[model samples]
Target: MSIRKVVFPVAGLGTRFLPATKVIPKEMLPVVDKPLMQYAVEEALAAGITDFIFITARGKGVIEDHFDKAYELETELARRGKDDMLERVTDFMPEGTTSIFIRQQEALGLGHAVLCARAAVGNEPFAVVLPDDLIAGNGRNVMQQMVDVYDRQQGSVVAVERVPKDQTDRYGIVETGELQERVAPLTSIVEKPKPAAAPSNLAVVGRYILTPRIFELLQNTRTGAGNEIQLTDAISALLAEESIYSYEFDGTRYDCGNKLGYLQATLNYGIRHAEVGEAFREYLDGWNNSRDS
Candidate 1:
């Protein structure tokens, strides 16, 4: 079956970004000019996903507003003959795309946020995208690459990247059976294991293409690390029922969940932005020269 629906679990508190995220969602934070959420949505859209299910919480109404039409803003821009600005605001969301926002009442873990979209996702293979992981694809995006693996494996596919062994505690570590180029069959998955206990350095990132059976497993899954439901646990259980493949996606992923990563993403994207790339480069060069002097 063709993967058409995508679930975005955006209900987290984003405590790392505190103060700023107090009002605005972390996903709404901009990298260069575009919001992180927009990038994730564009990636999914490129993968031909039509239904967007956002499992959001309170104060995330801005997210809904961002994707929805800004009537007054559009009208003012149109009246002022700001054709480019008007089009930019109005064209953010594509036609024929269905966006459904469901409130995740509590601050549950990733598994719970995904389970909240059970009704919207129904019983089909769907992709889960976390906007915090801003991936820049060389040609094909991360989600599209995972979908390709899903097409061949026809079970579940998760995106993995080799993190430093010491950083294994920060990610869901995957143990692979054998290396088949970029794709590997997962032998086991451990969530946030210590450096000494980590099975392998292949850490799972935020992109996932999962079958509907995951919802059932998540429902049965008890609280694990941090006393919150973990998606890694459910994916572990899924290994018994079906085969799951881990694809080492080809891309540079910016971990936008923290201040350092956010700044790095901004710098990287600003340097490559179409409108301001050259100017930014010149400014950086002058700044570097002044510092050296």
Candidate 2:
């Protein structure tokens, strides 16, 4: 069966973004005109995911409202004869697609947040996407690549990218055993290992195609780094009984969880945006010239 379900873990405190994130969820932060969470949802839809499950915490109700039907806004736009704006809200959600919101209830780690959606996911393979990691692909969307990998392998697949050896400790590093086309059969995964102990520079990123069994493994997993239950640790345990592959998906991923990555994403997407591209590029050129002088 095709992977039809996806879990979005949006319960993070956004501590990195301090005062702004105190009220606004970092996922709601925009890259140009689209928010990170909207981009993630659109990517999943492109991958043919039928169910959208959002595991959120307190102060995240805005995300639910954002995805929900805005009847009042649409009606007002129609009354004002703004068909373009009306169509935008009317078409915000895909036809025949539905969304489910689950409460995480507590400030837990990624693993716990994922497990909160166990009921919504049921007994099927699903994709897990972190909205903070806004990945844009050239030919196909990021989740589409993972879905394609899942079709052939029928096992779990993760989107990975090579990082510098010294930076390996910043992410969950994996060792490649053998190649299954573009997908690498993972031999082992070490969470935040030091540079000297890192097996490889391949760092696991946000996108993941996981089997239902992950819920079981996550349930038994003990807290690791930062005293929070780490999803990388749970996946490691699943490796003994099952096969999990990592594929370096074709994409330029923006780490929008922090300030720098967010700004980078804004600049990158801004220059490519059809409405603002020309003006934005001109502005950038002028700013660069001034800085040089």
Candidate 3:
């Protein structure tokens, strides 16, 4: 089946972004002109996903509002004859794509957040994209790449990247079986294993195309590390029954959840904008030269 629905877990308190995030949802943080979540939504849209299941929290009402039509803004823009800007702003969601919102009252864990969308996902396979992990590439979106693998293999798939061995403890490390270029068939997954005990350097990123069986696994998943229901645990359980594929995406992934990665993504996207690239490049050049001096 074609991947038509995507689940976005936007319930985290974003503790990393203190004061500012105290009021605003971290996913609402501006990347350039648009919020970070907008990028993820756009990426999913590009991958042909027509349904959105946002597992949001209390402060995440702004996210739903962001995608909704703003009558006041539209009227003001139309009165001012600002059709171009209005079109740009209002064209976020395409027609015929269904968007559903569900509240994940408690901030349990990624697995729990996903399970909250079980009703919407039903028994079909669905995609999950973490807005915190902003990925950019020349061609396919990361989830789209995984979906292609799922189409062929008819099972679960996850996006993986090779992290340093020393950093294995920071991510869900996977043991490899058959290697198909950047795509690897998974044998098993170990959540945050020590560097010396890491199965392989391939660490799971935030993108996943999961089967409905995951919801069943998550329903019974016991709280593991950090006293939270981890998605990795459920995924490990799924691995025991089904074949899972991992694809090393050809793209730049920015962990917007981290301060440094957020800044890096801001600069990278800013420097690539047609309207700002030249000016931003010159400013960076001057700044670098001054720092060196």
Candidate 4:
């Protein structure tokens, strides 16, 4: 079945971003001109995902408002002959597509957050795009690449990228078999395993094309790492029954959940913004020259 729906788990407390996130959802942080979540949504749109299921928590209202049509503002813009602005505001949702938001009442682990999306996903396979993993792709979105891989493999596909061996403990590291070029059949998945015991440095990124069978596995999954239901634990069990593959997606991922990553993403996206890139490059060059002097 074609992957039509995508679940975005956005209920985390975002403690890493503290004060600013106290009022604004971390996903609402601006990347360049748009919020971080907007980039993820656009990427999903490019991947042919028709339904957007947001598993959210409190203080995420900005996310809902950002994607919804601003009727009042649009009316004013139209009255003022601002067609360009109106087009930008009204062009968000595609025709005949669904954007539903489900509230995740408690702060649970990623596994529990995904479980909240099971009803919307039904029996069909769907994709999961973590907004925190702001992937900057040259052309194809990371999720699009995974979906294409899934079409051929007709199995679950997760996005993987090589990380430093020492950083394997920070992610769900994948153990894979012989590769088919960029895609490899996953042999196993170890979550936050010690660097010494890690199977490989091929770490699973935040994108996944998962089957509905995972809902049952997630339901039975127990609390893990940081006392929350880790999605890695459930995927580990699902691997025992179904075949899952890892696609070494070509993209640069920014972990917006971390302070350093967030700052870096701001700079990266700012430097790439069409309206600002040239001026920003000049500014950066001048600043670096001044620092040396």
**Compared with the true structure, what per-residue lDDT tens digits does model 3 show for residues 1-293?**
88999999999999999998998999999988778999999989988899999999898898999999999999999999999989978999989998999999887889899999999999899999999999996587777777778888898888998888899998998887877867778899978899999888899999999989999999999998778899999999999888888888889999899899999999999998888888999999999999999
Candidates in order have lDDT scores of 0.93, 0.90, 0.91, 0.91
**Could you say which candidate leads in TM-score?**
1
Model 3 error, position 105 (Å): 1.5
Candidate 4 error regions (>4 Å): none
Model 4 weakest 10-residue run by lDDT: 85-94
Model 4 pairs in collision: none
Clashes of each: 0, 0, 0, 0
Better of 1 and 4 by lDDT: 1
Error of 3 at 158 (Å): 0.5
Model 4 TM: 0.97
* Candidate 3 structure, TM-score to reference: 0.97
Clashing pairs in 2: none
For candidate 1, write residues 42-75 as lDDT tens digits: 9999998999999999889999999999889988
Q: Local error of candidate 1 at 242, Å?
A: 0.3
Residue 149, model 4, lDDT: 94
lDDT of 4 by residue, 23-118 (tens): 989888888778888889889999999999999998888889999888899889999998987887787788978998999988888899999999
